[model samples]
Target chain A: MATIETTGLTKSFGDVHAVEDLDLTVEEGEIFGFLGPNGAGKSTTINLLLDFIRPTSGNIEVLGIDAQERPAAVRRRVGVLPEGFGFDDPLLGREYLEWAIETKEADDDPDELIDLVGLTGDADRLAADYSTGMQQRLAFAMALAGDPDLLILDEPSTGLDPNGIQNMREIVREQAERGTTVFFSSHHLAEVEAVCDRVGVMNEGELVAVDTIEGLRESAGGPATIQLECATPPTELGVADLDVVTDVAVDERTLSVTCTGASAKVDVVTHVAERAEIVDILSESVSLEALFNDLTDGGRDGDDADSEQAATEVAQ
Target chain B: MSVRTVAKQDFLSARRSRALWFATTLFALLAVLIAYGSQGYRLSATEQVQNTFRSFGMVLAVLLPIVALVASYMSIAGERESGGIKFLLSFPNTRRDVFLGKLASRLAVVAAGLTFIFLAATAVAVARHGAFPVGVVLGTYLVSLLYGSVFVAVAVALSSAVGARSRAIGAAVGSYFVLIVLYLVPTIRITALVQWVHDTMLGMEPNPHLYDAVTYTSPYIAFRKALNLVLPTEMQQEVFRGSLEAGGELPVYLTDEFSLVVFAVWLTVPLVVGYVRFEGSDLE
Candidate 1:
C-alpha cells in the first residue's frame, strides 16, 4: 500500500505560498528523499503531511488516514523528527526514551538504542547536561521508539559529526530494511543522493522532478566523458572538429574533449589512433552534478523555472 | 508512562531540586516560629499583624497566579526554547498526553508545596495557641489550592501558545499582570470598551466581586471563609475575640461549602479549556 499520498497539496502563509500544487506519493518501506535547497518547500510539505499546519487547498492521506481530519490517528503510527526541538526538563536521556516507549505503547530496549546513538554513558544524566549532538540522538531515539510504521525526518543530520552522519544514514537504511517507510527531507544533496532510492526535487514551492538518482542524472544532461592520451601532439588529432565534440583541451600527452553524446566516441578513438600513439583511453559517465546543473540552469535567468530548483524552493 | 508514573516522577524530581528544599526549610522555620510565638494570641492585637502578613505573604490573591505561571506556564515553552520539546513530542504520544503528563507533574509539585505550607502554619498555630483548629485549617487550605490549580491549567495553555523561550516568558508574566489588573482591583475595572474586551480573558463573569466574592471565587479567600465556617465553637469565639474590632462578625455566606463549589468551578473551567486546546493543537 502507498504509505502516503498527497493530491495537489498547497499551503499559504498570508500572501506567500510556502508549498503549492504539490502531488507526491511514497510507497511502503521506501526511502524517499524530499530534496531541496534551504528555502525549498520540503519542510512546509512535510508539515502539511503531519497536519502541523493546514493546507490552503489540497488533500493528504498519511498512514491510511486523512491528515487534517484525523491527525492523531496518523500521528500515532508515524514518527517525526522536527527541524528544531527545544525543552527544559529534569528527565534523563534514557528517561525520555522510556517515555516514548510508554507513549507509543511499544516495548523497546532503551539501553540498546541509547548505545546505538553513543549515549550509553549519558543515559542517566539529565538531557540538559548532554551536548547538542547527544540531545539530537535522543530525539532520533524517540522517533525510533514504538517501532513506528512510517518515519518522517526533517534535516535529521543537521548537527552531527562525520561519524554521526554515517550513523544517521545507516539508521535510516536499517529502518527501511525493516519495512518502515522512510520519508525525510534534507538540504544536504549528497546525503539524499547516497541513501535515497528516489528523490523529489523542489524549488520555489513546487516539485520539479521526482525519480531515482540515475533518472535525474540522465535527465540532467549528457552521460560520461572520453579522455584520450596520444603518442603525438602539435594539434595533430582532430579532436575538436567532430560534430559530437563540444570543446577540447590538450595538455602534454592527454586530450580532454567535452561531447554532446557518446556517439562520436568511437570516431574519436579511431582518429586518435591514426594520428598519435593510442597509449590509453578513458571514458567517464555524466554525474548528477552535471545533470542537476543543466536541469536547474536551463531557463533564462530563472525566467523558466527549473523543475529541480522549483521543487526545492520554499515559498515562505 | 501512566499518569501516576508521570506524577510520581515529578514528585521525586522536585524533591531532588534545591528550590523545593529551600522553600520547605523556610516554611518549616516560619511555621515553628509562628505556632510558638503566638501563645494565647488575642484577636484585637494580632489582627494588625495578621492584616500585614495577609497582604504580603504567599496567600495573597496575586500569589496563586504567580505560582501557576512560574511552575506550569514555563514548562513547555522552556523546553521548546532549549530544543528539548522536539525530543519529547517526537514520541508516539499525542499532544494531549504530552500536555497532560507535564500538567500532572506541575500539579503534584504545586500540591506538595501548598500542603507543606499549610502543615507548617498549623504546626505554628498549635505551638502558640496551645491547640490548632486542624479541620478549619485543612478545609480552607483545600479551597485555596483548588483555585490555584486553575491558574496552572491556564498557564499551561499560555505556555503552549507561545513557543519561543523569551516570548513565552513575557506572555506568562504579562498575562499574569493583566489578570491582577482586572481581578484584584475594582476601580480600574471601569475601563474603555477595548479594555473590557481584553479583560474578558480574565474570566467570563470577571470574578464579579473582589474580596467579598473571594469566598466563592478566589482560592485563598474561599479557603479562609471555609476555615472560619469549620472552626469549633470555642475557636470561633476565640477568632471573634481576636478580630480587628473586638466584637464583629467575620463574613459568612451560606456556610463554608460555597467556597468549595467556587473553587471547584475555578479549577474545572480553565482545565477544560486547556485540555481541549491541547488535544487539538498543532503544537508547532
Candidate 2:
C-alpha cells in the first residue's frame, strides 16, 4: 500500500511556480529518499503533503486519507520534522519531548526517546542552551513520539556531526525495520544512497526520476567499468561490437570495458577470455552522488531553456 | 484536546517568562501605593474607599493594558517568526485552536494578575480606612479585567496577523498608544477642539452627542462608566457631573449596560479578525 501519494500537485506564489505537476508515491515500510537541489520544490512538496500550504491544483493522500480534507487525521498517524523548525527555547528538552508525547497521546516513555536520540544527558537542560546538533536530536526524538506509522523528515540530517549522522541513519533503519514508512528529503546524496530503498529525484519542481539507487545509475548510463589483466594483449578484439559493452579500450597489457549492468559483466568477461587468457579483472560502479549531479545538471539546462524562452517573450 | 494542549503549553511557557513576574510585582506595588498613599488626605471612610478605588482604576486604565500587552504580544508572532509554529501545526491542532489557545492562556495570566492587584488594594483600603466597599471594589476589578482583555486581544491579534516578531512588537506598541493613550487622551481634547471650531468658525451649536460618542469609544471611559453602576448614586452623579453639563443627564449610549457591551465588542472584534486572517494565511 502507498503510504503517501500526490497527483498533479502544484503550488504557486504569485508568478513563481514553486511546484508544478508533481506526482509521487511512497509505499508502506520503505525508506524513500526525496532528493533535490535547493529550491527544487522538495520542501514545497512536503508542505503540500502536510497541508501547510494549499496546492494550486492536485490531490494528496497520506496514510490513505486525503490530507487536505482531513489533515488532522493524517497528522495524527504521521510524525513530521519540518525543515527550519524552531524550538520553544524556555522549555527543557525533556519537557518538549513530554509535551510531544502528550500532544500525540502516545504511551511511549520520554526517557526512552531521549536515549534513542542520544540526548539523555542534555534532556533536562533548557532548549535555548542546547547546541544546534542537540536541538536536531531533540526534534528527531520528538518525531518518534507515538511510534507513528509514517515519518516525514525534511533535512533531518542537517546540523549534525558525522557521529550524529551515523546515529540518525541507524534510527531510520530501525524505524523501517519496525514497519514504519520513512519519507525524508535531503541534499546529502551519500546518506540517501546508504538508507533509502528507493529514491525520487526532483528538479525545478518536477519529479525527473524515481528508482532504486542502482536503477538510477543505470538510467544515467553509468555502467560498471571492468579492467582485465591478460596473459597476452589481444589485438583486433571486437569487444565494442558486443551488445553489453558500451565502450572498450585497450592499454598495452590490460583491456578495459564498460558494461551496462551486472549481467553485462559476465558477457564482457566471456568475450575477453575468448580472445586472451584472462588472469585477473577488477570492476567499479558509479556513485549516486555522480548520478544526482548528472540529473540536476541536466535539469539546470532545461531551466536555462525555459528562461531563454521567457526572455524572448518579454522582448517580443 | 489539541486546543487545551496548546493552551497548556502557552501558559507554562509564559509562566516562566520574566515579564509576567515584573507585571505582577508592579501591579502589587501600585495597588498598595494607591490605597495607603491616599490616607494623608484625612477623608472619611467612604471618601477614602472611593478615592482609593478611583485612583487604582485610573492607574489600571494605563497600567493593566501595558501588562497585558507585554505578556501577550509575542504569543503567536514569535512562534511563527521562529518557525516553531510549523512544529506546532504539525500536530493535530488547527489554526483556530492555536489562536484561541494563545488568547485563553494569556487571559489566564492577566486574570491572575488582576486578582492579585485587587486583593492587595482591598487589603490596603481596609487596613488604612478601617472599611472597604466590597461591591465597588469587585465591580471595578471586573471592569478592569474586561478592559485589559481588550488590549490583550489586540496585541494577540496583531501578533498573529504579522509574520516578523519585530513588526508584531511594533504593531502591538502602536496599538497600545492608539487604543489606550490616543483614544482616551486625544478624544477629549479633539472633541473640545471640534466643538470650539463649530461654535466660533461655523457659527453653529456644538453637538453634544458627538462628544459622548467620541468619549465612549475609549475603553478607559467605557470602564469608568461600567464601574459607576456599582458605586453609590451620589458618587456616580458626582463623577458624571464633572464630565458633563451640571443639569444634563448622561447620554443613552454611555449607560453602564452599553459600556459592558462595548467592552465585549472590543474583546471579540480584534480576536475574530485575527483568527480569520490567521486561518486564511500560509504559515510560512
Highest TM-score among the candidates is held by which one? 2
Candidate 1, TM-score vs. the true structure? 0.78
Question: What TM-score does the predicted chain A of each candidate obtain versus native chain A?
Answer: 0.85, 0.89
Residue pairs that clash (backbone atoms under 3 angstroms), model 2: none
lDDT of 2 at A64: 98
> Which candidate gets the maximum DockQ versus the true structure?
2
Q: Give the whole-model CA lDDT for all candidates, comma-separated.
A: 0.66, 0.83
In lDDT terms, how accurate is model 1? 0.66
lDDT of 1 by residue, B85-178 (tens): 5545454344565577778787777777777766776655644544444445554466546755767766777776666778777877877665
lDDT score at residue B125, model 1, on the 0-100 scale? 60
B215-254 in candidate 2: lDDT tens per residue? 6777766777776776767566332332376346666775
Candidate 2 local lDDT, A1-316, one digit each (tens): 6999999998999989899999899999999999988889999998888877899998999999998888888888999888888876579999888888999998999899999999878888998788889989999998899999999999998999999999999999999999999999998888898899999999888898999987876666446677888888856788899988888888987888877765688898888788789898886666676567667763454466653342222100
